[model samples]
Target chain A: MIELYESQRAMRNMRRAAMQRGVVAILDVGSSKIACLVLRFDGSDPSDENIGSLAGQSGFRVIGAATTRSRGVKFGEISSMGETERAIRTAVQAAQKMAGIRVDHVIACFSGAGPRSYGLAGTVDVMGVTVDEQDVARVLSACDVPDFGHGREVLHAQPVNFALDHRSGLSDPRGQIGNELACDMHMLTVDAQAIQNIAHCVKRCDLELAGLASSSYAAGVAALVEDEQELGAACIDMGGGSTGVSIFMKKHMIFSDAVRMGGDHVTSDISMGLQVPTATAERIKTFYGGVVATGMDDREMIEKGGETGDWEHDRRTVSRAELIGIMRPRVEEILEEVRACLDAAGFDHLPSQQIVLTGGASQIPGLDGLASRILGHQVRLGRPLRVHGLPQAATGPGFAGAVGLSLFAAHPQDEWWDFEIPVDKYPARSFKRAVQWFRDNW
Target chain B: MQPLSRKSQSARHDPAPSRLKYRFERLKLTPGFRFCIRVVLPFALSVGAVSLWFASDDNRLAFNQMISEVRETVESRPEFQVKLMAVDGATSIVAEDIRKILPVDFPVSSFDLDLGKMHETVVALSAVRDATVRVRQGGILQVEVVERVPKVLRRGDRGLELLDETGAFVRLANARADYAKLPVIAGDGAHDAVKEALALYAVTGPLKARLRGFERMGARRWDVVLDHGQRILLPETKAVRALERTIAMDQAIQMLGRDLTVVDLRLTQRPTIRMGEDAVQAMRSSNTIKAGGE
Candidate 1:
């Protein structure tokens, strides 16, 4: 194995060890919720061939998970450090209790802060008949590293696929005889400070940092199938504080985007329309929110206690039609924005014909029909895939990233190790996260 | 008597040096040595100053020359001669209308000519299938690219640009390439998988010389074809190994010499072969039954 590859594998193995002892945690610090899953990994002998290839590839099983309502976060930014830390701790402890283990290593995901995408291309001639690992590294380094803004940094810069002369879409060009090799890579950039803030919050919870992924990307991994990923498909994860969209093709995410409006906005709309408290409106929306109202729905009404302490004016009923009327327009608006994002991503231009909807807000009644109409394509409600030993509480769309992070941890995509990192003969630290912990720690 | 007495006294005492002798040893620095040191110090200092001035001037000139050489070399290279194709801060520039960006004496020689880069750029055009880039001795870089002509245009909310196995996506604004018989990838991820299948096809080599179309079954695996639609189902895993096995089977059985469809290799060990429509229906039916029993 190459030196860099070995080192990365060692690091991953260390993470695997920490996760396997029933103490690995995943922290999803989003605008809407701070979810923590303390997963107890069931270890199989790494050298055992049967275990190594249980599913023709690597696999993992999850044992515990938990989530908590977030505070001090607004659209993915940590405004109050102490409050966020408390939320993270609460979620982690709850998950640990459920798993019956103590967790120390955590992999976290975050959404919002306006992620941007860029396309970079590179090429190199194969010195030998077969493309070797060195050739792959050389071509990747040959790609012009784009200049993101001063404070922003590249989080994920991956060679989605490669093409040989006259042939395209080669996943691993190595060991194939080719005179020349070229690669089209998708790069994602985010605010460096935002990443540090998330890491800091997790650190405050006393958990070791294992890895980090964009929330939208994690959702795409769990929601999209191999076929949808191989061709072209878009995943729209609508959470409470933000709606994230990720585009996948060739089993890799090519584009990721997000809008700062989600389930919370719909709840706010319901509260305003019904003239009820925000809490009551939330309960009503979850129970009876609808995008399309029928004649039967118009006659049906519900009773609610008024705020005024007058028993005589206590009960009032609003038709379900009225509720649908208020919710449909807002849902339509969110979908329209999502459609715009897809258009901006040039989604239709891709060979993609399928659209998957996930996340907490995605489960709303009649959302699929509304999304299909607005998105102008086939839309399906996506649920997180089944993994071994997942608790029933974690089966909701709200747990998508937490569950997917578990899967990603089990079967990781090719990282820097899968190929070699071109050494300017310098240490990997040159490329490490510059802002180590949040500047606020000072 | 005095000399003998002094010798006896010295041997008896084995005495330490007297104060006068100790003082003489302490003040060993003499005027002659001091005069020589004082004269040499000023002369050495003057010589050093003169040499430092000349050395600094020479160093400055050398630095200037190196910078100019690097600048000249970089300026001479053609815009696309470098594999990176970096138009630094020139996002507004169009790749097609880049004639003006080409440097006059671009050093095509120094530029590493990677055919793969040219192939990738061409494949990205959605028009090209097979791309070949070559640099002659005279420093002329020639690109001969064959494009995947769209057989059917897929209409969605946004206009679609589809390429065959190579993932070439041509914008709607761009002129369509001449190869129109190539089938387009329709579903999501289809375009990318088609490219993967094509790449896997390259490994097929001699067998690819007999292939017709490669279709991706959306989220499922590939359904490959030989001349006139002979389908081969490649399993999701061990794809490369399966391709190798298929080639071996082709050579051993001379299957490529005949018309066939649905060569199922989903099972790693057992390879199923379905004869093409050109074969006698009765015979094909009999073959399926016989193979099933086996």
Candidate 2:
């Protein structure tokens, strides 16, 4: 954990260096596609009262964007190292070309790897009259880190809440007088192997791993509006191979979990149930995929075509109702898993439990109605927040993770490792004074 | 049966640039690397190549030869050739002296002629006050000159050299009789006081028949000698004013015509006269006769 803390601190330093350079690249390794966006931090006027500025106070603009079909990636985790590296190269190179500038630092995100969240609380007496940055760091270090099992890496550890004595829910408690300083932190851990694979691929590409974030948390940051995040909302990013569930409260992610099933499962179901090729089944699913079958669907027939030699095998027809029947259960299963995750995270206890579904798979027709029915009465389809110079084609729900990664690069949430570990036994003032006396005499 | 997604999926080319090419493209995008490639590299390469090529002795010689050859052809153009020398605003003698001192040949290229040095040489002659040498149109090396006309002839060690108004030597005369129109001054350092000598000579216009020349005695004061071996001594400072005072005395009292040997005006407060031998004798005889008669 200490080693990871050092490395994370090093990465934060690299992020600062990249910010000084004014250019950084964001990579989202998703199950369906690998998206790369080059963000240019122009360090624009901070005093300008322009609310519509890109990424708010951090004026970063997306100068170049490119996406390529992902290969050797499963459930949003790199499965085959070489192929995934190739795909990443394809996307990054195209984006670099479009941007006309080379980017040396990359902040990457992934959604799979079974991310697990832990809430930690720690308290310490204020070192002086008022709480200082050192005291805050000491309190954070005082938090007892869980074992989290072996071969697991901490992805994100953010202080979700702060309390100075009786005052709770304090976003910033520094310079506030208090006898006791306590902090509630949200920490997410994923498989270390997944992180290693990503780091290795990025190393092969000759890029510095400046930072890493969970795709689910990133998507929540992008999809949930300011009000929803302030009140409380759950963003269910229904990706191709997985559906990520994240709950944001007071502008911070409180809980995040991912179901291992998504739109791919629905396509597989259609392929298996309709006795058709996966490609044809995928086409049919996109054209007529839905969770709620109607009476008029039975009359609409879809040609699940193939080029097989057998004439009967080449031509296969199924009604739209049957296609919906095949896809509806799979979608419902994914949503149910998300609901279970929310329930486990105590989503009902939040002040406002708004559920927003967004991702590549969230584009399913009538999914909002179906999600509302299955998950909660409040459900809406979500898209990524618009940013400067983002292509119109990449502004859909599918690009939530990529867009969110850009925002993360521009303005990253502070993590536990961002602070220094204050040395316990520092030299006393008397010793320094003695040295000063010697220097004066000499 | 046709698969609807075939068109979209067909011919999917995975465009992963090679490692070298990808890195090269990135290097091209880097501001430092791009600057090296687009600006520094090209400049350095050209400079290196040129320096390398010219490092060879034969090549250096050839390059220098080429340059000189081009310069020679331009210099030898007919329009640049100065065919003749023309000296104006000078006497024939000064012109001859200018031609003798200048080291140039006719039909020579003007580029090979150093006009500034030629003008300095021409102006070096005492007769020429100033000269400007320029290659004029119609292929002429024209030396425009301003010659100093001698104001007074000084009989010095150089034997009657002509001096201009500022006491600058212009030329020498065979004898003082040749320049009778000019006042003759003879002294150890008389050229330096030509202006005063000339002014004194002009004041003697009334007694021009009796005025001989000025002798600069002890190189401090002037003594104007007349036809009868009589002289008027002048003070060093304001000699011209002293000479004018003497001329007024002469005009009023015929002072120079009397039997007086010298009129000394060296001390402005005192005017003294020395009698001639004849005048002294006559005065002595009259004194004896008057005594006897008394």
Reproduced native contacts, each prediction:
0.00, 0.67
In model 2, what lDDT does residue A413 have?
Answer: 84
lDDT of each prediction vs. the true structure?
Answer: 0.70, 0.88
If you superpose only chain B onto the true chain B, what TM-score does each candidate give?
Answer: 0.39, 0.90
Per-residue lDDT of candidate 2, residues B1-294 (tens digit):
224563563325767777888888888888988888899999999999999999999999999999999999999999899999998998888888888898687889989999878877888889888888898999999999999999888878868889999989998899778888988888777877888888898888787887778888987889898888898999989888888899899889988889999999999989899999999999998998989864
Compared with the true structure, what per-residue lDDT tens digits does model 1 show for residues A1-442?
2543454455567676775564577788876777877665555544356344433223455656777778768776677675677677667666665665566688878877778888889888876688776678778878886887777756566688788886898887878887889988888888878877877877666567777778888998888877888889999999887888999988888999888888888888988987888878888889888898889998889665577877755676788889889888888888888898999989998876689999989988989988998997678888877777678877888778777787777666765445665544335566422332222144
Query: Can you list each candidate's DockQ?
Result: 0.00, 0.54
| Candidate 1 CA-lDDT value | 0.70
Q: How well does candidate 1 score on lDDT at residue A287?
A: 88
Classified by CAPRI criteria, candidate 1 counts as: incorrect
lDDT for each residue of candidate 2 in A1-442, tens digit (9 for 90 to 100): 6798889999999999999999999999988889999999888654366464443735888889999988778998889777788889899999999999999999999999999999999999997798877788889988899989999999999999999997999999889998999999999999999999999999999999999999999999999898999999999999988889999999999999999988888888998999887777788888888878889999998888888888988777889998888888888888889989999999999989899999999999999999998889889999999888899989999999988888877778889888755444224556645654575488
What is candidate 1's CA lDDT for residue B290?
87
lDDT of 2 at B129: 87
| Residue A440 Cα positional deviation in candidate 2, in Å, after optimal superposition | 29
